[model samples]
Target: MQRPQTVVFTDLDGTFLDHETYQPGPALEALEELLAVGVAVYFCSAKTRVEQQAIANEFRVDVGFVVENGAAIYATAGAATVFGMPYAQVREALHNAAAACGAAVRGYGDMDVAEVMEHTGLDERRAQYARQREFTESFVIESGEPYELSQAMGELGLRLQRGSRFWTAQGEHDKGMAVRHVTTQLGPNAESFGLGDFDNDLEMLTAVDTPMLVQQHDGTWRDLHVEDMVRLSGIGPVGWCSGAELVLRRHNAR
Candidate 1:
């Protein structure tokens, strides 16, 4: 077996960030080592561009980021390349759907970050943290069937990515597509690894050569399509960091 130049792409929440402190642990060190050896690290996440950019800066390295659940891609220098439906088109469709379902449609584009925070009742600090970086954009419909919203977005040339607590019109774009794009850019001989821990990460996990899911607070592993999905023993970023290191060690041995 050949050991090709590797690139690791990881989802943020519940994967790279400690669920409590929102900080990276040994995973960051592992990534640094990979970079020391000429490997690349990227963050593919549902987080907005703003959020992902901040993380990239914190790590002090350039990152290829897929924001808005793959609706947009951004390079480390802050140049953005949108891949899917325009936000305007998605907004119109979501508005129509909200009216039909008698729900209120709220999003980040139409309002400032503060307004979105108020509507969603999210913590102000977290909202500010998300706003400081501009990588993600999302819309939610309050009071309607989530599937109805999904169907509506589908009709409008958008797709709904269902997370633990919200539905958004992100289009058919997903982490899998983002991974393919990055891998293609990196060349055919490049090896890939992925880490994630939620329903939204399914496509991403399937696209990688190695997929690992960090354990949740409940001590259960999220179901994944990969045949060799490894369940980490700890919760949040610690588990993710440990799992990523293990995967790399195993792959390097092979």
Candidate 2:
């Protein structure tokens, strides 16, 4: 019997990378193992291409990546391409919606490097990279009801995603749409495995043949109702490694 070609779509911050130190840690082993067996692991993240590029270089893994919450995709062999609304349009709509809703919204583009560093705990270089938004932008509501902001955004044909630390606004497409796009390019026979740890990851998690949810940094798991979703035992990358290994073992055994 021929094994199905494996492809993994994973969240970065709190899934493949440690939520605190932002390193792959134990997940590096499973990543290498997957690569050795010709599996492609695409990072689906809210980070900009610049930030994702830096992380990819740090890990020394060459793979396709979906950035800006599925706003764009950068294949390992081709240029980056947009899959969502233009960043300029999204920015204008966001501001207009926030104003109409009477919410004080502050996004990454509205902040300097110092302010970004203060808010995200990222160093200056990373903060600079994070601010280079090409598709999606993250903001916070400083002085208004979140529901009002959400209602306003929806009225303007935009959507808001609640991430671990900030609220992101972008086009209709999310990580699941990006994953589906990548899967088609991988050929009809390729099977997908997705791993994530937050509500924002729900789309990607539910789009895969095997969906895995790992424990968060604080030891709580994101509650999601997906068919056959696997909940791993460890937190962050530890659970990622375990879940990946388990999936691979079961997949190969069949």
Candidate 3:
């Protein structure tokens, strides 16, 4: 197989999609340009595999995806490189860890489909997709401090990561580990780029040669510090566009 010279990994929520609207309208042009030049685009995010595949289907461009906060990587061929514990295992461990830490948490497993729709602002169909978790669990911390819960989780070799809206429990993993896995497949010379807008994205950003942070909906950048990281001023898709433009220039595709 011929080697890819450039690869892009972007977070979905609050990075490539609007935090509230979940639209990628502004970034479409740049995204198309990247695709036109055969630049690989992968959505690396906390979204479920179904949600990620839906986005890829909508845009019709997905070399692969890192889903559930790096719980797994799904190639376009449908093969998955898994890094997370099974969903059932993670869910059970989470409750046990939370109980030990005296944390009151409400996970998706505890919610009905309707309640998941309400909390996530997803329609019934999308809500079902969200609940179709294969690995890890997303939950709201109802009454416990995250620090204590995190420590308790560590004892079981699990971890808790905070996304834009909820906390996730899974095997110790992060987007960076998945990013590295994809780039390695692309070969050592492939220049990887990543974009994100939250602390949850720090690991992913650090894993790329060109890391960029999009401004949040509140017009602020994440306090994510990484060497040679670029800060884009626009929120969500706008910032994604700017970053994509830079990638195009770097790849000499524009």
Best by lDDT: 3
Candidate 3 minimal-lDDT segment of 10 residues: 55-64
Candidate 1's residue-wise lDDT over 27-50, tens digit each?
Answer: 678667666766667788877666
Tens-place lDDT per residue, model 3, 44-136, is 988899998988788776558899889899887788899989999998888999999899999999999999988878899899989999898
What pairs collide in candidate 3?
A: none
Each candidate's number of clashing pairs is: 9, 0, 0
Q: Which stretches of model 1 miss by more than 4 angstroms?
A: 1-3, 76-81, 100-102, 110-115, 118-137, 247-254
Model 2 C-alpha lDDT per residue in residues 7-102, reported as the tens digit of each score: 899899889999889999989888888788778788998889899989889889887889988888898887766777878888899999989988
- Whole-model lDDT values for every prediction: 0.71, 0.87, 0.88
- Backbone clashes in model 2, listed as residue pairs: none
The alpha-carbon lDDT assigned to residue 180 of candidate 3 equals 94
Candidate 2 residues lying further than 4 Å off, grouped into runs, are 1-4, 250-254
TM-score of each: 0.83, 0.92, 0.92
